[model samples]
Target: MFKQLFETGIGVIAIAMLSWILIWMTRQARFLKAEITDSIKNALGEDNRADWGIFSLIFIAVFWEGLETALFIVAKFQEGWTPVLGAIAGLGVAVIIGMLLFKWSIRINLNQFFQVMGVFLLLIVSGLVISVLRHLDAAAIAFSHISSSTDLCGIGKNSCILRPQIWDFSASLADRQFLGILLKTIFGYTQKLYLIQAVGYLLFWTIVGSLYFRSLSQSTQLKPANKFN
Candidate 1:
């Protein structure tokens, strides 16, 4: 019981942190370059070691990206090796892209790149919102069983706390199936979905998605004006 609860808590924290980071990045996308430049300039002015300041800046940036990647991988660990493999593939692609952009001095539309990736991540995290709620519900059910609390879940209910099961598509497109697993990994698809889970998923996309797209649009609008000025 304790172990299940602990794992669930970790998953929740990891998903929450990932979601927060994604949304924050969307909102700060426009200012990130300027902020980094300013930070580097400030660091360089603090001492005579300009090279050391630059190195420090690079170290911090790499450390932050690594931390985010670690958290994401940890969050997906319960799903088995598939997601891990996918993450490794993604890292390779990212490295290649970085080399092209930085080392080869290739020009890419960073704003568009971020916009597309932001949308993809938001979809994934929205699914994660559902996953977190389901995990909490499972933990609650497990605790109720261990404690012998019959009242926690009424008879014939599929969930102890997530409300009645809305639908079970396991007979048709079971989550264990190849396509189902793909959807589950990419979009958080589930064979059994509860009312609360559906509501939570939609609410995440509605609120977080709105904020992200709004910020993205604002950034796009401001970019041209800033360039002209």
Candidate 2:
């Protein structure tokens, strides 16, 4: 009960909050006073002795993401270090990436990063649908297990894993169903995958990942040009 709220609630609130903030930022942009704009511009201008525009961007992004995650932890967990820890870990990764970006001035391969993260999110979505089915089955008073022998299993190698037994979350300390729910919310997963979802996931990952990595590979091979008047 508590676990579900902490896990799922965090996600819902964070997304909503982010959306709200973006809308507010857009609306407030025109109202920003020229004095304020000039001050910020001075701080961010490329001519500044301390190049802060990049840092400012990274700081705001990480801060808001961290802040939202923290609120989620408090609201859903009712009070716990889990969300804080999660935010910290995420921040750590971002910091490492930021340092690299600053030290090397080379543009990061965002395409590849998006492809990797996209594939991971897709798998989570696929898993979530299947997990929800299991949750419903568990809540059922007289659930009957179906046989893999059903036509859905497929005639040959493509056959589904025969009436897949819903995952038993009991083995782990926290009920896996509950944990799976948490993962589905946080990481995303599906227990019983539909034929189409599986194919689509595979196709998207293959196409996107391939293209992104190919771009990276090509970029790496490009020779450095001498910049002179």
Candidate 3:
């Protein structure tokens, strides 16, 4: 009972923080979009000292992203310190890439970079849905036991209404194995996947994929018209 409350409280707070950041970003999307576009084109060539506002905007944007990431990391601490290590490694790579881009005048297609990162983030969000469901299932089961009711489990002692394992691939690829761990971290692979978890993942991808493809189709349709002009 207490464990469930603890987990729920922490998870809720972390999600709320991240969601607030997301909403704030969305609300400031127009200004941020223009600012970032101009900043990238200038590539720090402009005298930031002259325009203190631009520097403040850049600092605030970076700080918000960093704060959101920190909250997300806390939310995912159940995945262990591997994710923290990965974040550190990724930060190093990002710093190196930024240096190379600025100092070396390396050409990078920002559109492609954002598209790839968007897809990666979508996958992570889907995985988080599964994680949330898994946690909810545990809490529900715990509550059922305390209340002396089998409502959460449904049919049997081992059977859970929300988290009944749909399939187990542990025989073929153990989740503890290196490959399994890699997939789990990257793509949220599970040896014992639950029904609700699968549903949530599939539903998320389905909706997101439809919207993404539709946007791509619209962009493709508009490109020729722009070129003709």
The clash count for each model shown is 0, 13, 0
lDDT of 2 by residue, 1-229 (tens): 3343344455445534543443343334334444676776777664665456658778999899878877776675655777667767876898888888898786755534654664464445444434433333332212122334344334333223323333433445332576656765664454444454445445644654454455445543552432420
lDDT of each: 0.81, 0.49, 0.66
Give the CA lDDT, 0 to 100, for residue 101 in model 2. Answer: 89
Number of the top lDDT candidate: 1
lDDT string for model 1 (132-185, tens) is 777788777776776764558765556888887899999999999999999998
Runs in model 3 deviating more than 4 A are: 1-53, 56-92, 149-159, 171-186, 219-229
Listed in order, each prediction's TM-score against the native is 0.67, 0.39, 0.60
Q: Is candidate 2 or candidate 3 better by lDDT?
A: 3
C-alpha positional error of residue 42 in candidate 3 after TM-score superposition, expressed in Å:
14
lDDT of 3: 0.66
Better of 1 and 3 by TM-score: 1
Indicate which candidate wins on TM-score. 1
| 66-116 per-residue lDDT for model 3 (tens digits) | 999788777768898988887878878999999999999887765456556
Q: State in Å the error of residue 224, model 1.
A: 3.9
